[model samples]
Target: MALNAAVALGSMFFGLVALFRPQAMPGRPLTSPGSQMTQPSEATTYFARMYAARAVPFGIATAAVCILLPSQAAIWLLAAGAIELLDAMVVASRNPREAAPPLLAVVVHIGSAVWLMTA
Candidate 1:
């Protein structure tokens, strides 16, 4: 129970950090050629919006699952952590800019998720 709560809180914290400090994301070029590319991709703007828009909902759901069903919480938390980490990795690999924040963020997020799940 305590573990789940911690995971939920941690997930929320990381998500919020990503939302508020996206620019702080590291491992990507400060100004990648991709940056010139249209963001949220015109076609996928919906997906991007969905992610950004629902960040709160996802966090809430994660908390609910954690509090209500710890066993199942891990799957969702893991998925969320994996997604964030993978996004960071993709950004890092594709561009060469700042590698500190994104890398650190990913590590923290995944580390917290893993720790919470195991706890």
Candidate 2:
């Protein structure tokens, strides 16, 4: 599979997981398995579900556009990358150490989009 497919698949998978099992999300205080907190709160659960609600559709649309319309893919891909950038910024503000992966994702998405446009 192509890198874009992989990225979209990952996003969809995680979104689905978060939607169905918000407590399974990593890094979340009370929700995450690795976290020390024992009790889950409504706020975290709400955020997890909301993230899934937003991310799942975004992933699908971006992947669909990239496949069905390559020229338009650049815009979609950049949008996907921008989401990662926003996540990176948010994560960085909370925990700098946890921001690397999202930042890398931003690079991959944006770089691929740029290459597609330039090609």
Candidate 3:
């Protein structure tokens, strides 16, 4: 439960950063620091902001479920895990070299989901 809360808060923080300070996001090794998208086009910026917006709500919902509706936490955690796993796959497909972090995140989400289910 505590772990879930922490993860949720962390997600919210990153989501906020991604939303307001997309410039702070890490980029690929070949790209400039804090610039994930190869070319900083309007469409890319829009996508970044949109992703951030989605993450913010997801984080809030996850935290709310963990705190206010404990019984639903397991299902939510599992869903989050599945989402992260798919995200990892997408990241890997786009950039194999930079997939480690997302893969790690998928592991953490899945592990947390398992823990929640067992607890």
Q: What RMSD, rounded to one decimal, does every model reach?
A: 6.3, 3.5, 4.5
Overall lDDT per candidate, in order of appearance: 0.53, 0.76, 0.66
Over 1-119, each residue of candidate 3 has an lDDT whose tens digit, in order, gives 56666676666776687677665554421334465545454554565587678678887888788788876677788776676566567657757766665565556667877876788
TM-score of 1: 0.43
Local lDDT at 66 for model 3: 79
- The list of candidate 2 runs beyond 4 A from truth reads 31-39
C-alpha positional error of residue 107 in candidate 3 after TM-score superposition, expressed in Å = 2.8
The local lDDT score (0 to 100) that residue 50 gets in candidate 1 is 43
In model 2, residue pairs whose N, Cα or C atoms come closer than 3 Å (at least 3 residues apart or on different chains), thus clashing, are none
Candidate 1 local lDDT, 1-119, one digit each (tens): 45445544554565565455544433331333466632323323433344455555665676687678766655676665665566556556756454344455445445656776678
TM-score of each candidate structure, all chains considered together:
0.43, 0.80, 0.69
RMSD in Å for candidate 2, one decimal?
Answer: 3.5
Best by lDDT: 2
Model number with the top TM-score: 2
- For model 2, what is the C-alpha lDDT against the true structure? 0.76
